[model samples]
Each structure stands twice: as structure tokens, then as C-alpha cells.
Target chain A: MDQALDLSGNKMTDLGNGHAVIEYGSPWGRPIARWVPSWGEEKREVIERMRKHLVQRFGEDRGLRMAENSRNMIIFPNLVINDIMAITIRTFQPEAADRMTVNAWALGSRDEDPDLRKLRLFNFLEFLGPGGFATPDDQEALENCQRGYRNAREAAWNDISKGMPRVGPPKNDDEEQMRCFWREWRRRMSAAA
Target chain B: MNADAHLARAATASGQCTRAQVEEFLYEEAALLDEWRVEDWFAMFAEGATYEVPPTGDGDELDPAKSLFYIADDYVRLRERVARLLKKDAHSEYPRSRLRHIVSNVRITGFAAGIADVTCNFITYRTKRGVVDTYYGQHFYRIDCSVSPWKIKSKRSVLDMDQLYAGKLTIII
Candidate 1:
């Protein structure tokens, strides 16, 4: 569901940095620039926190558990980032050079919203494209980076499988909920009419 | 008139549309792209057409040498680009895209010897990931003498907005 704005509403200017605030003053007036001094810094910290929490929640033993046929290898590099959810390294056939697939997620928020617990998660599953797997030396390097995640925190999962096969197109669940509300509102209006 | 004027007049003797007609043709072409009619849009270009998207600077006619995205050599490359855009295999268009294109301020910058240079300003509305991304750019088109059929010999999309707002450059600018 796409968000539609009434073009005839208040005068709006696109600041180009994922933000647009409503202006009631003079359309020609130079409004104060919307500033988020702690935006980038806060995001960085939250990412770190999320990483720590995940490790503690999913211990090494349970985190790496998989189905017998999964043929998956998990590398928790010492320099692991919370922003990166999980990276699965797999091989297609015995002779094929090891192929790497990175499963990373970005946590962000909309403007004027500062709910860390309510952060939005965007997932990206990319086949790192033919090279750069965890070599024996690389495997040794990641062992140093596996710290435990902080446990007992709220968490939610969103599947960001846009543009990927068999994974239905990406959708904004919130937007769909909003659409349902509007549909219900219209139905009620017609009933009252 | 000098030798140049005589050559120009001789060239103009062949079939060619007026500036307004050329603009109308381009405008219709833009409409096809905006509506996501991929095959119909491809039919607009001439055989062996050259499409170029130069990495422009503050200056005009950005040097081809610095072009970020260039297809100066062949039409097959353009076809490949359009093919990838339409293909479901391209990860960039997983959800496909909803776009609205606005082309305006078209001007015939030059006309002589049956070769004309055309310019226009445009704005694009690219929507995906629940966001609407805006892009502004100027288009440069050079019609060749061999373009008796009034086909576009060359097309250069010189964008004013450099930041790629969308996830990828899957659609034509």
C-alpha cells in the first residue's frame, strides 16, 4: 500500500534527506532546518546494542543449529555488527568454489520518531557474487569476535524479500494495516449514508 | 550565403519534421516510459541508436570520458539494459516500480545541415519501498543527417539530481 498525500494540502518542501515537515507559516518563509544531531550517533549505538542482545539471546550452540541437510556454515567474525543479522556460507557442488551469501539488515526509523524499540528492519539477502568466502585464516579471525548477545529484550522479525524469487514482493505491513482502516472507515461511511 | 548555408539548405530538402513536431515525438516517447510500457518505449528509438548517460559536472555537455553510465558504442547494450529492467531476474525490480515522468521546457538548441540538437528538462517520480523519490534532469538529443526518418541518433540524459534516490537505476531516466 502506497501512502498518498493530498497535493492540495499544506505547502511542503522536500529536504531530500528522508524528511518533509508541514509548514503553516509563509510558503516563501525560510523555515528552521529540521535538525537531528543525535540521529546518526543514536543509530550507531542502537545497532551496537541490538548486536549484543542477539548474541546473548541466541547462544553459539543454538545459533548455529540447523537441519542436517542445510549444509550451512556460520561465521561470527570478531568484527560482527548488529546491523548484519546473519551471513550464511554455502557450496553448490563439491567442485564449485565456495560461494558466500550475506544476510544483512538495516535498522532505521521515520522522521520525528525516536522509539528505539520500534525501529524498522530492512533485510538484504545478497549472494556476495562468486568470491570472498571464509578461508581457513578467515575462520580463525572470526572466532575472536563472538561476544554474547544481551538477553531478555523485545524483538520482532520482518521478512524483507523484495526482488527475490519465491519470496513474494516486499510489503510494508503498517501501510497495509492503514489501508484496512481506511477501507473500514469508508464502509462505515457508506453504511451511515 | 556561404558554402555552409548551401549545404544546410540541401540537407533540409530531405524529409524532416519541424521543431514542434520533433518535441511532440519526444514527449510521446516520455509518456511510454512513464507508463512502464517497456516494449512500446523500445520501438521509439531508431536502429543502431546510441543512448548515453554522462556523469555531468556543473558545466554543460559533460565530457564523455567522465560518463558514469555510457552506451555510446551500440544499440544492443541499450536493449540489454531494457531487457534486464523488464526481466524478473533483476533483483533491483523485485517489487517492480511505479514511476511518473514529467518532460518539459523542450527547446531546439541547434538546427543546421539536417542535424538538430534538442534539449529538455524533466522530473521523475520513482516510488518503491513505500517512498516516493524525485529526480530532476535535462535531456540532450542529437538527430543525425541519416535520420531522414527523424530517428534519434544520440540521447544523453544529463541529470541535475545526482543522488540515486531509488534502490537502483532499473527504469529509464
Candidate 2:
């Protein structure tokens, strides 16, 4: 995913003090103080079409739900959050790392709930690419939160898997996969040792 | 037989805490949770007992201090959490999602002195806003069998997923 914006056509002019605005050709286009980049006409059209389809399939409420969900990982949810995540990490803000994190968080109770949206920010941090947070403590907190989940969707039976291969030899896909898994497990273990 | 085997057998025989008792206790506890009786569920643990779901980042083990866990709660904290959830404004669970905790594969892996090591498999189905989510996991219990009916000295749940099923982990697994 090309996470960084194409700043080839954009210009950053210093507005005195520590603040500066990123201008995308037009003088009157950007939001007041906040940097919200406008989506190109093509992307906007595509978003509208997807939005309509989702609304029709899942109804109005749910259509909106799906759009709000994964906003961090997917298209820029409007301009503010996109600017925070995509822009701050590249340009460097006063708060730096946590700045974008906090700004992305300050977004809204829009997508999911406020809390779930905040949590999802950390979940989708992978898409943000690598960089340190504002403080070491902040980084540690994010890692701790990420590691807290069991992260299980479907669980494999260790006991049953070990015991219940087919009566015959490896004749089926399941058996083949299991054999492959065991072989790979052994290879990794031996290599590690 | 080794002394450890003898001791294990002796403990099980003396305590008379059969697999059936442990199974029953687990079921009753599940019922309270299904009913959203969080406080009653909290009472199932012994005083000063810990209810833990260890952070199995890539492996299954109980490392309290080093790894971050979904939940590693002492009795006091458990009480506080349950209390908070019971309030009307606990938005995460205010409406309370419907749930069915299907527990199976019960086995008493070991018994020694007052503590019995029992394990079980579970796949709980939760439905909220018409979306059904399945959570599969294993629960390991350290029961204090010294008493007539054993108390859950500690419980550690190992969920199968690397990340939570949904973004939110609102209920007890």
C-alpha cells in the first residue's frame, strides 16, 4: 500500500513561528490551521459508488458502519485523520510520533465507538509504517496493548491433531498439510537449536 | 511408581474431588456469565485468587510480569471491574451481547496436594447487532481441592486468535 501521499505537486510554505501549512496549489483550499488534503476527483467518485453499494446491501446504518471500520488501514477517512497519520509521520510534528497518534485518536466517535476507534488505531499501526512514538513510554504502552490480545479466530486441537491422522497413509489434503506442518515445525525447531 | 505419582494419587483419593464436581462447578460459573451476573461470577474465585488470560504472543505459557495479557486480575480488581460493568452506563456492555459458552474436552490432567490441574476446551458464540462471533480457547484451572467443593485458585484462558475476535473485548471469555 502506498501509504505516503504524493507530495510532488504540493508546497510547504513557512507561516512564521513553528507552524507551516502544506498547500496543494490553491490558496483557499485547505482547512483553517488543520491540514486536510482533498481526494482527487477519481477517488471521490469511487468512494461515492462504494458508499451507495454498501448502503443498498447493508442498509444505511450498516453501510456507514463498514465505511467507518478499517478507515485507518483503508482510504483516508476524510482529510484530518489521513493528514495526521500519513502526513505527520513524514513531515514531523511538534509532538512528533504521538502527535499523529493523538490526532488520529481525536478524530471522532464516528467510525466505531470512540474507544474502539482508538484501539483500532493501534491495530492498524502496521499500515502506518515504522517509526518511534513521541516517548518511549508511549511506544511501550502501544506494544503492550497490541500484545494483550489472544488473537484467536479458529483454534487448532493440539491433542486431537497429534492423535487423529487418517487410518491409511497420507492420502488426503488434511494429512498432507499436517505432515507438512510437522515437518516445518521440526525444521524450525532444529534450526533454532 | 515415582513419589510424585504416589502423591498425586493420594491427593486425588483423599480430596474426593471428582472430575464431575469440577465439571459441574464450571457449568454453573458459565451460567452466571451467560446471565450477565458479573458479580456472582466473580464470587466463584477464592479470596486473593487470580483470574488470568496470559499473553500468548507466539507461545502458550504463564508469564505475568513480562508479557501483557488480555486480563490478569486479582480478586479486588475483578470485583471492581465487575462492579463497573454492572452499572447502567458501562457502554461497552450496556445492552449486553447475547452469548453461549460451549465448554467441552474436560480432563483432570493432574492432582497433587491441594491443587488440581484441570483443563477444558471452549468455543463461545457471541451475537451482537446480528453479527455472530465465535471465540475458541482453552481454560486451565488450578483448583483448591482441600475444601469439600474446590475453589478456583486460578484460571488462565488461552484464546486461539493472535488478535481479539473483534476490536472490542467486552465480555469475559
Predicted structure with the largest TM-score when compared to the true one: 2
lDDT of 1 by residue, B1-173 (tens): 99667546544643463556766778788788878777777766778887765433443555433322322324665666666567655545545778888888776667767767777898888786566767678888877645544667778776675443332344577
Cα deviation at A165, candidate 1, in Å, is 25
Deviating ranges (above 4 Å) for candidate 2: A1-193, B1-15
Instruction: Please report, as a residue range, the 10-residue window in candidate 1 chain A with the lowest summed lDDT.
Output: A26-35
Fraction of the real A/B interface contacts present in each candidate? 0.00, 0.00
Error of 1 at A179 (Å): 40
Candidate number achieving the greatest lDDT relative to the actual structure: 2
Worst 10 residues of 1 chain B by lDDT: B64-73
TM-score per model for chain B alone? 0.77, 0.86
TM-score of each: 0.43, 0.46
The DockQ of each candidate is 0.01, 0.01
Candidate 2 local lDDT, residue A42: 34
Writing each residue's lDDT as its tens digit, candidate 1 over A1-193 gives 1134221222223322222222221111110111123234546554545444444576433322210001111121211222122222232222222223333222232352334322221011111111111122232233222211122143332333333342442222213322333445567678899
Candidate 2 predicts chain B with a TM-score of 0.86
